[model samples]
Target: MFKSFAAKAIVPPALAVTGFVIVCCLLLYSVIKTDMLNDTIRHETNLADTIIKSTRYAMLKDDREMLRNIIGNIGQQKGVEQVRIFNKKGVVAFSAHHAEVNTIVDKKAPGCIACHAGPVAATSMGRMEQARRFIDARGRSIIAITAPVYNEPECFAAPCHVHTAEQKVLGILDIGLSEEPLQRTLATLRMRMTVFCLMILALTVGGVSALLQRNVLMPIRELWEYVSRTRRGETGLKAPVYRDEIGELARSFQEMAAKLKSRDDDREGGSDPPADR
Candidate 1:
């Protein structure tokens, strides 16, 4: 009876609960990781765009100092690692880190690699193609995005700048943002989610096991005990009633017991013998 109760009432629910918890944890983790990645990308792209808009007038007036100041100020914003303006020749025309100004960008660098597939840059790139991610020298993850500076009437007509009608792309605005802060936040959230799921799983499984033991296993055990007592000649034993297959079995047992008792009573009351012949 103990073995039967363990198998039927305990093992199945435990296995089910474990499988359910594992699947939920995996699905939740996957969703959280994807959302984190998208948010980081969007944030970096927006920052790059903001820098481009703020420095446009300075670039048109050929004011190097104003452009440097704008890029430097934006670089101080939280999570922004570096900012640069690259000319068509792949030269660092301006940079937040002043030391990097005038330095030539490598063809294989994250910011330029997608556009400069070979010796020349791609004639045009879609908005989505300008975003990339890589690891920095300090091993921190970094998201880099670029926004192209296009030639407009104001740009070509500026007295301080050279005129060019054929030029479509003037320069590229590049921004790199650190992902360390985001990574830390995600790690903490993952830990909390794991703990919460485990707690719920434990409570659910425990409640189910307890209910099964009380409603199913206990009644069956009681019926078995009642039958054993009756077999030992105990009187007045009653089979327990349940509303399932077990209940039907209990009813049959009670009927059999009553029949046995009636037969015993008849034998005990009968007259000793039909006088032999």
Candidate 2:
């Protein structure tokens, strides 16, 4: 009977604690993961902007070789996957991978649609609207940011280039960076969080179980043993004092047992012949 009672007391609360830990851990993981992803995106966007600024002088001077070299050098960096400049006609004007130069990019692709919302909007695309992300052919996650190469005064005024006041947007500079490193970092963080959560769960269950045993289960087991001894005709049985509802119960049982013993003594005195004085 005590074994059954102990199981009932321990199992339910342990399960509840485990459930609560899992729920809280899941919520925390979601928030951290989202923040990490946004930080990665912001970092990659700044890199793309730097690339555009670095190539601006070459673009103004109409130096195709210099522009190609800049793009190729940056593209070879660790995190950069590819870099290219797409002209107004969706044709690749320059690319780090030279084979891609002169190839026509599909208008429906995310890179093109970023600037080319439609035929009319494509001509007036602002510098603010060029960032997007997608997965590449090799199943690697890619984040692409587009910076518009505007036709500045120096570009139109240069003797090497023809006048182009009407051409607000000269071309689109696209930078593709790999997301594999960020993904790996997030994976490591997730594993650590899971392990930490498991540790917390184990500690909580152990703590709660120990508390219940000391305050509840152990007292109840002692009370059961006292009752068994009393039922076997034992005398002078004393219930342990406690400060809980169980303590009150133990006091009441002790009072009742004392009253029974007193009544039995009274009956023995009455049955005697006036105490034989």
Candidate 3:
């Protein structure tokens, strides 16, 4: 009897709660992961912009030492992997990592180079600056931010300033940042979310199981015991009572048992005598 009550009352609610928790957890994890990835991308892009502005000022002043120092500082910053400066002629003038210094990077490279090289497109090279990402030799995991190094009229004159919008490229600043750190951060968040979701599911299942046992299983078991007693010829068996659906069901069972007992007794006492005798 107890087993029957547990089967009907405990299993369904437990299963329902478990399934709900699992679905909720999966949804939350997906949302958190997407948000984290976007946040990391925005942070890295902002860092690139800051570095570009600082290096631009140094370059305009013709401060090679200061420019090198600034580039080195940017490279040391978290998420920054490498930094390179290109002159208007598409020649690598300075690099944070020594391996790239004096190496000529193709002006036709992806990102800003696609438009910044050859003749300066009016739309591409405005008074403001632009930034983008491209793959380096290592892979397509590098971000390349570029800003044109214009010769300030007060600082550079004549030949250096002669280059106009129609002239050949003057210079570009490129900064490359590693994507590993961002990915790692996102992975950690997903793992944590998974763990938290599991914990919630376990708690929900346990709570549902307990509620079912108390409210449904226990009362049903008591009612079953009453019916069994009456079946074994016990008189005046007391039916289990309650205030909700379980109580109403117990009352109906008690009424049915009384009618069956009455019918059995009438047959045994020969309430209808056989016609032949």
Number of the top lDDT candidate: 1
- Clash totals, every prediction: 0, 0, 5
**Model 3, runs deviating above 4 Å:** 1-46, 106-144, 150-162, 259-277
Model 3 collision count: 5
**Model 3: per-residue Cα lDDT over 151-243, one tens digit each:** 445444544344554543466666666767656776787787678767766776677668877887788789888878877888777788899
Please say which candidate is ahead in TM-score: 1 or 3: 1
1-277, model 2: which lDDT tens digit per residue? 5367656776777678777877887888888877876776677667767887888888777788998889889878887888899886768998888999999988778777655575565554343455567899988888777776778888888888875888887777888888888789878988987898788777777887788889988999898898888878898978988999988998998887877777778788785322322
Better of 1 and 2 by TM-score: 2
Ranking of models by lDDT? 1, 2, 3
Candidate 2, residue 56: Cα displacement in angstroms equals 1.5
Q: What's model 2's lDDT at 115? A: 51
lDDT (tens digit, per residue) of candidate 1 on 26-84: 89888988788777777777777777778887888888889888888877888888888
lDDT of each: 0.80, 0.79, 0.67
TM-score of every candidate: 0.81, 0.83, 0.67
Q: Pick the candidate with the highest TM-score.
A: 2
